[model samples]
Target: MSVTEYRQASAFGKRREPHTVIIARGDDIRHFTIRPWLAAFVGSVLAAMAIGYLLATSYLVLRDDLLGATAARQARMQQAYEDRISMLRAQVDRITSRQILDQQLVESKVSELLARQSQLTQRHGRIGPILDRVKGEAGGLPESAPLPASKPELRAANQPVIYADSSAASFWSKRPAPSGPETAADRADRLFVAINQSLRAIESEQMDGIGTLTENAFKTADEIASALEAAGLPVDIDTDDEAVGGPLLPIDAGMIFEARVRELDEALEKLETLKAIAKEMPIHNPAPGKPVTSSFGVRRDPIIKRPAMHAGIDFRAPTGTEIKSAGAGKVIKAGWNGGYGRMVEIDHGNGLTTRYAHMSRIRVSQGDTVDTGDVVGEAGSTGRSTGPHLHYEVRRNGTAIDPLRFLKAGKAIGKLL
Candidate 1:
């Protein structure tokens, strides 16, 4: 067919035209066509569209799965946080309870200390005055005065709260697992440290107070001993020397201090004994009122014209005046003796002895125990005397000393005399 007639017929029949072209490159010529090219381009575009659609669908599905996983992780984190909060609240409650118990224990200790202080105050009447003197002295103390006690050392908080990551990525770290705030052993150790510190502080304060008291007591004893020595009583305050060449007679300040300390210890023991006895002893007087006329030691003897040694003092009273035991003792002698008519000698402990001479009648017999102020005899001048009087004498180890010393030391001379 002719080209014009074929093209017209193909156009009229609605069929596409097929064309071929020849291209020359260098020495070679290549033939190219259009109908097969269109077919190949269309097939490639469809394949590309299908591949892109598949990729888009896979991406959407994967994104949806990731969102759901993220939501689940958030829920788990919330739950874990709630659990940690609950655990922290429990730990706080435990800590609070322990703090309350510690406070109660501290209050109990404070109450005990206060009670002890009160008891000590009552036992030592001079303590108040001494404390006042000390305070006055302290008021003028230098600013650089030594501090004997200081604050205690406190330990740092070794344990701290730690939060755990719930994510699986970090679950297997080699570090140790988190523990609670504080364990029972930790609290016990802290409490023990606190108690030890408190005890040390108390000990320091007590030692300081005792040192001050001992110093003052020694000073007073020294003054008293000096006065007594000046009074020509042959008074020497000395401790038993153990060393061979130790001062045969120590009258120095050191010896005086040692003696004073020993006496103070003895006095404390005696005070305790006296407190016990005061609880049981009768408060009322059981003896008749016998008026005392003469005092102890170095008095004029009526029978002897010359100056003579009068061992005991005389109490001028009626013949029926009752004689009493001054303190608790056992009766040793209640019969007659030379120069003393109808005398009763009572032996109290601690080398103390009392004798009641010139009695009209004897109420207690020998080997009888009598308490303080117990009626032992009736007052009368039964011995070689001029008038009706009772002779009273106090002796230490069978040697006559001043009876007034005990009466004065007892601070109850008015009641007895």
Candidate 2:
């Protein structure tokens, strides 16, 4: 058993006093007095120990909860990081796919452009020769004026927005890289557009050439017809009575190039026929460097000294001077006829004839072919003439026509040829 009692402080000091303790074990009693300072010290030590024990208990109970919360926060952060990575990967894949598609489309367009260029080159090779021939026949100008040798190119458009990418190096190399404000795809598009423009230029030039040829050919034909009409000859090129027949099959109007080529060919053919006819017509002067002694129509006769209709022009040629045929023809009468002595009548085609009279000697016999400027006979005053002269007469369908008209037309025709 133990008993402890605390004595009050003294009235004078108002401070803590001593504490007495009694302990009895088996009737043995002992007493001990603790001083005021020692009692206060003991109480303070006990209070500090109680507070320390409570703080340790609180820390031990909350440690697991704190650790769990930190782990959860770390897990959320890792998941967020993974989601971000997945999004970035998808974006990269989409970009890559788009780039690939663009590259493929560009390649396809390039191939088509190349193929078209080859075809245009081949067309130029054929059209160049045709254009040369047309220019030669047109005498420098066709229709209105000369056409441009090469067609102009198409103009460019507004610039496109360029994007950034790592895979831009695999494209065209001729255009040095670090290209400003334009991507590889845009550059390729520009190249293809230029190529198409070049092809269109080629097509335009070809069409222009065809049109020029057609115009010139028609003009030539018209001029030739006019010449033949003025010279009292027929433009014997038959167009309406040609034997042409075919089934009315479907025609392709889209084939503009081929259509133009065909049109040019037809015009050239018509012009050629007119040219042939003009070539055969009598448009040449029979006597070179010989002055006209007598004009045709209502002239005083040189021998009779009376007014009479002169059917031909008389060229003052010396005796035995060479006389050439007026034009291409076949001789029908090479011997004498009536007062026109030593007459040689040539039957020119298309209901026409020429009379070369007053000749001393005939070189071409009947049924013999004679070309223009061919020496037909030697000149002498054998016909009804007073002096040594060559009488040249042109007759259309057995009717005497003026020879001056044919000679004048020949001068105009020489310019075109």
Candidate 3:
């Protein structure tokens, strides 16, 4: 046990010897012997183990760095994805807000349009009667449907319907034409513009029609007034009497139709006044289809053999021919008169009077109201040397004027009546 022994061995054609290792500590020595082959084997084993350990250490260190880098990269990727999502969300929110604002604006526009529709409807009602009354005289306006001509609802369950042009001052034009592709809102807006333009055109037409009617009415009234003026009668119509006293209610600036309506009303009132006066005068023929046999003038008296003033015209007919009043009036005198058989007299106010002489039978009594064409008497030959005929006189204040003048004037304005 104290001596080391080694057996000889052959390796790679060389004789191998045992290797020795000695250790000394504090003068106590120890020695160990190893065979050469064994030593080489052990050295090889140790080198392999060192190499394996170094490789394992390097792999662990590299793996930690790789894991840390990978984690950082993943975190960066997650943060970037979230940032993209946030940006998209913000854009969506902005778009939603804008859409909401647009919806509200559209709703406001719809409300304003509804109000205008109501206004236009009221206007139609106001002028309906006036339009009817002037149909015959002033070429009638075209009949149209009531205003606000569309449905009131501007939205459906899923989408909004943006139509109905409003009366707001700003809505006078069709604005902000749609671009890109046509949407429901765009289509509805187009419809609104078309409707608005069409309705406004109708309103414009109405205004024009009323203006024309007023002009024609004024013209007719002027004609009547001129005719009456030539007959020693003056028409007195106060058309522009500004005796208005009321609260200062301001109207919308867009209400130009009101002025037009007022003008038409004044014109109509004036025409009505003149027409009433014209009707009251001796305008209609007392005897329809009756021809005048004798004209009123200084002529040879058939029975007196001298030239005398013939103050009335004579209409020869059968003795029992019906006679009528020349105008609307109150009967002043009726029945027998000196040399004029059964006579009838009418006082058409304003100092105008008419007489029907040589009547066999008088139908109207004193104080009886008689309209134009009313049967007042029957024609007869009881006047001074007159055959079966009617003697008609138009006198003013008891003096005879040319009955032809009144007749001509009546014929001139007959169509207007």
Candidate 4:
């Protein structure tokens, strides 16, 4: 039906009729009548009341369960959040501890490197001048020239140019400490990386310096060896022959750097020892500006008037002429012998000795330490001589070799000195 017809029918029906309900139970009967709209309204009210009662009852019965479930879910969420927080805290603690340890290691390395560099600087200060003197004596390159550039220098020179980054110390020092929790971890990470890079650069420089120093040490050692060989004395070189055996322990960069420094120190010590030994040996002119009167070996003895092996050379000098020691040594004999009157015998180390015979006066006593060029006595014809002359002999293990060899060697070495 159309909407207007339906509405008209509903209006007529509401105006015309009232409905009645009757109930009969056993001996009683009841009847009631009402308008249709009022009955419908009363039925609706009854249905609404019944539904409200049911909803109220259900809410009373199930309210505790619903609230308990909600509380349990909230507690689980809280526990989960707590567990997550604990895990994150643990991770943060571990990361913080690791970073602290790394920082400590880097600081220690930096301290060690600083100490090593200081030592190297001191050594360079002390040894550089001595090396220059040695090179001057050896006729090596001029002192102003760069000391024979090494492989490290060559490599550095050949390397391509690189942009420099900010210095770690400055960068870290300038940065303010993070105030917020969110950025603290990131800041720590950056700090560790920067520190690591700085340490690497410092270690690299140290290694390169060690390489150059080692090369120079070897070169110096070679020169010393050659000098000692020319003197016919065996060189005592350090041969690090001790065996190292273990479970193959691992070594870090710092240990290697320290070992190189130690090696350089040993080499320098050896060089010093060699220099001291060379100074004490007999290697200087004994009687300067004196004419040779007699040569060594077989000659006619002036007193005996027969051919005899002359063990010493004779230098003609006027009476009271100064007789100097050839090298620094302890005097062993200074009194008169049967043929050698007022003689002086010097005990140079290593079984080498030099004797000056026929002196007019002995200036040094036995057991007195005399240095090279120190006046030991006066030249005179005191014993077994036809004229005032100094008889000089070089003895090795109580047997006399030609003294001319040592004189010639001294003359050659004196030019260098």
Candidate 5:
């Protein structure tokens, strides 16, 4: 049995009373006393303890949920970080691939340009000998002024970039990694610019060489024409003074190079034509390495001692020495002529003729085509010749001029030979 006791105090009295609680279980009883202030204090402590236990229980019951939420948030953050890294890697790969493609394209163009430069070099080699020949012929001519020193040297663009794998190397080395796409792209762009500049330089050099060749060809043609005119022969000079007419078209680097090549070809053709004309002209020495015994113009006649006009120059050669044709022509007369025994007359075209007088034997008949070095007869003291001397005459329309003029022209032509 259990019984509880409560004691009340009077309002005016100072006496304190206690409340007692009894509890019995299986014939056992327990009593507890509680004062007003003590009860209040104990009740407050118990209520505080109960509140704390409730709060702790609530936190324990919800701990898993809270922890799961925090873990989920952390997982999401890690996923976001991984995705960003993946995106960065993809961006880097794309940029690298694009850069490689651009580099390959530039290399291809450089290869083509290098091939063209090689072709130009070969053409220059072929023309070198011809230029040397022209220079030799024009030894007395004034030298051309040197080109400007400021001319840029031709650059071969085929050289590869030094830092081809710089971007890849930056990833591993201590050097700062690439900041962004702009850095890689800028490097490729710089390479392209360098190649383009090199191509332009080569093109400029080719243009200069073409110009020089054209000038040399023109000079040579003019010199040949001048020499022909000075020989008192009417030269039918062909001039290309007409203006060319065509529609204006856009020109590229390859087109410019082709145009230069065409110009060089035309110049070479004109030079060749002039060379042929000069070859056919009577400008070769009849008796090479032989001393001149008598000169043309007013001189005392060898047979008749009188101050008279000598229409031909005489060459002193040994008896029976080979006499070659001065120029390529057809022998018109090979038999005896008045005052010129054993005379050989070659009728060259353009109203020019060469006469070789005083020969021992006539080896060529009339209507025979004789080259410049072909043996026509043997030298001898025949007809007006005094003693084993040759009388050579260059006549234009049958009017004799100085044969020395034609022989002097031979000096210029000999250089080409």
Candidate 6:
């Protein structure tokens, strides 16, 4: 083939190239080389590398952002959990504080109760023996007789010798053991149980003491009555019958003693309740104002010319003098009576009754309950009285008794009249 025909075939097979290439500004030289395949391969490799780099960078940034967000969310959740935990801890602390305060208060109250119980026990400790002697005398028992002057040795030895150590020995023997180490809640429970047990023990002991005292009192009363009967005095013993105008009989010693014991028990129960309420109250005398204006016994009648049996003791006072109840009881009658003007009759259970006569004003009505030292009336001269005075009578089953004996016994018992 000719060169022209060859050139034409090559031109049709080759790709287009740049027209010129400048080497210098003034005098330029131009050269051209045909390498289309190599250029295209290089371009494709560079483009693919750029695209891969960009995609890898984007993926890395997105992964970092996602990890940071996940970490933040986890941190927030942890903080929330910690906050809840803290709140719960605070609540627990508050509850614990309150529980501690309550426990302290209870302990204080219990201590006060214990102290009051101790005081009461001490105050009433000596009353039992005195009452026993009296009861023995009242029963007319052969063994329970007063010693004659000839038997000085027996009388001297028979007298009771009071000692201070007796109560200590009893208390040490009866008190409960201290609680052992345990959780606070368990300890508190044990403490309360022990307190209750102690209270019950004290109550039981007090009741027993009261019963003994009552028995003794009855015996002494019986002995006194028997002595009076033996002395040629006209005395009678009655029970379960209302008293009339006639010479009333002496009370049944046993019944009167039992009644007194019951009354003491009831009074003790009330006192315990009061002590519980007044744990921190100040101590004071129960009877604030009291004075004995008269004594109990037979005397010449001021108005009557004939010898008469005196049923009660009279206390002279100015008109409108305040009259207080000597003990806890229920009012059975409050009004003007046949010979007792503005009288108030109180029934202390167990066949014991008290009458306040010649009162100017009655503060209590029938069926009204009154406590010891309660204002029941105003003293005045009424109903067959010579002057302004209070006629106080204590009766057992409607039988009159000597007021001096009871007053003296109450004083010996450490009672506040």
Model 5 Cα shift for residue 299 (angstroms): 2.6
lDDT of 6 by residue, 161-268 (tens): 222345644664686765775666655654554454454444445445556544444443444444334422333344234664677567763455356556544433
**TM-score of decoy 5:** 0.66
List lDDT for all candidates, in order. 0.59, 0.74, 0.75, 0.71, 0.72, 0.60
TM per prediction: 0.35, 0.69, 0.76, 0.48, 0.66, 0.34
RMSD of 1: 16.9
lDDT of 4 by residue, 1-417 (tens): 578867887877753445778999988999898877888899999999999999999999999999999999999999999999999999999999988987887677667656655654554554455445434433422233234212211113234322224565567568786676646447445544544454444445545655665555556556655665676655666666688666877887656756766775665566556555556677666789998878889998888789999998899899999999988899999899978877999999888999999999999998899888899999998877888999999898999888887777566545333
lDDT of 2 by residue, 172-265 (tens): 3345645478876776777666556555655666677678768877787788788778776767666574788888766652376778877777
Model 3 spans with C-alpha error above 4 angstroms: 1-51, 135-179, 239-255
User: Candidate 3, residues 112-143: lDDT per residue as tens digits?
Assistant: 66776676677777777776656544431223
Model 3 quality (TM-score): 0.76
**Which candidate, 4 or 5, would have the higher TM-score against the true structure?**
5
In model 6, state the lDDT of residue 153: 17
Q: Global CA lDDT of candidate 2, please?
A: 0.74
* Tens digit of per-residue lDDT, candidate 1, span 1-417: 688877887877765556677899999999877676787798899999999999999989899888999999999999999999999999999989988987777677667655644533442343444344334434222333322222222223352212222342234345354487876655654454444444434444534544544544444344333433332223333435566575577496335434544554543333333333431222222233545567766667677776677776666687887777777879999988767888999887656678888888899899999988789998777768777777888787889876655444333312111
Stretches of candidate 4 above 4 Å error?
Answer: 1-218, 222-256, 288-295, 299-307, 316-319, 408-417
Clashes within 3 Å, all models in order: 0, 0, 1, 0, 0, 15
lDDT of 4 at 272: 54
Indicate which candidate wins on TM-score: 3
Task: Tell me how far the alpha carbon of residue 127 in candidate 3 is from the true structure, in angstroms, after superposition.
Answer: 2.6
Q: Which digits, one per residue and each the tens of the lDDT, describe model 5 over residues 285-396?
A: 7777899988989998767899999889888999888888888899999988877888999988888899988888889999999887788998888786668877889898
Tell how far residue 358 is off in model 1, in angstroms: 0.3
* Full-model lDDT, candidate 3: 0.75
